[model samples]
Target: MEKKKLNHYDVAEVIDRFEINKVFDCFTLKNWLAIGTTNKLKPSHSEVLEEARQQLSIKWDEWNEEELKMNFVSMVIFVSQLDVPKHINTYFERKLSGKVNEISISVTVDCMLASPTYSGRPKNPYFFLQEFKRSLGDNHDPEGQMLAAMILSQKLNEDNEPLYGSWIQGRFWYFTTLTNKDYCVSKPFDATEPEDLLQIVYVLRKLKELILARVTP
Candidate 1:
């Protein structure tokens, strides 16, 4: 049987066929996006962010996906300090696929953080972060790719926990949460804006707290 690539899916296909609901309560959305960025960054972290911000202001519209990841996205991920390099680490371009409700699904996660087994592989996935060069249009689908990875994460995990993921395009970053059949997407957090960039860092740090709080091994 031919397998379905998760990147091939868009938001509508995930909602229409898989029965996932996009409608979320206003409060819930606010709570998810409520990490405090105002007083959180140290001076050292601030220096790195300012550099990244400057680079982004100059080149956001000109870079492709790879350039974006290498320049801007990596800096954000670094300032986020996902976790110590001990056991938890981030992996890139990793392939994941599983059977969800009898339908075959697969995806290449652009970046994810998770605990590693002794053999050096992601044992329990924690979050997905993808960078998109194209805006929301027919040629690409950020939400669909995100949802597909999250759904695949659910199937592979089976831990009954909420999943976190995001789609980033130049200055705009949209965070998402999938818990059970309900999912929510936050308003775009613009990286060009200093405040929003801080919020973006906080959210990335927040993922670390979320993962460590989990009961799984």
Candidate 2:
């Protein structure tokens, strides 16, 4: 079957209704505006993209024990509040065959920002993924974490076909290398404080709106 094209205007409307402007204001949305407005799409997007790529790639190798632990904790705290769509819930119910699995994880596979390459075409700018592991524990294995993500990809595909390519939809990922100590260290998902949680929710809602507007028709 042919895929349905996304409605960008509908998505933009969602963003506007959800106040995405306020949420994105906390991050590099301005930088994106500056880059997007340029006649010749510059390397500004690539620079940030490369940073995230390099960080994830390097982390995949060296494996920071502390960051791994932090990520696990962050995932647990943040995913607890996420609401699942009825269709996804029904799909999982059938897939698991009545198993009492409570955790539902989905990955974001595309980069939030993109720029045309020298050849005048867009390319993989960056990616990121977050998982809600079933049995929460203190285990810290980067390789295992990566593998688990891969497994989840297969399961999701079997359950319901994704919009983009399989890998893109399987991984909830973003890429940015700004390394602004504040944003990186702040750890949006790991926030427990009331104000911090509110901010995180606001940002996520805005991100959803922006994505819907940009990708959907």
Which digits, one per residue and each the tens of the lDDT, describe model 1 over residues 1-217?
7654443577788776578888656444465567763547788989999998998888888888888888888888888888655557898888877878777777778898877878888877878887456366673677787788888788788888888889987689998888878888888989988988988888787667667767335
Instruction: Tell me the tens digit of each residue's lDDT in model 2 across 50-136.
Output: 344345334433334335324332332243222222211101101111111232322232112222245533232211222223222
Best by lDDT: 1
Candidate 1 lDDT trough over 10 residues, lowest sum: 23-32
- Which stretches in model 1 have alpha-carbon errors above 4 Å? 1-7, 26-30, 37-39, 85-87, 136-139, 215-217
Model number with the top TM-score: 1
State the local distance difference test value for candidate 1: 0.78
Q: Each candidate: what lDDT?
A: 0.78, 0.28
The TM-score of candidate 2 is: 0.25
In order, what is each prediction's RMSD in angstroms? 2.5, 19.2
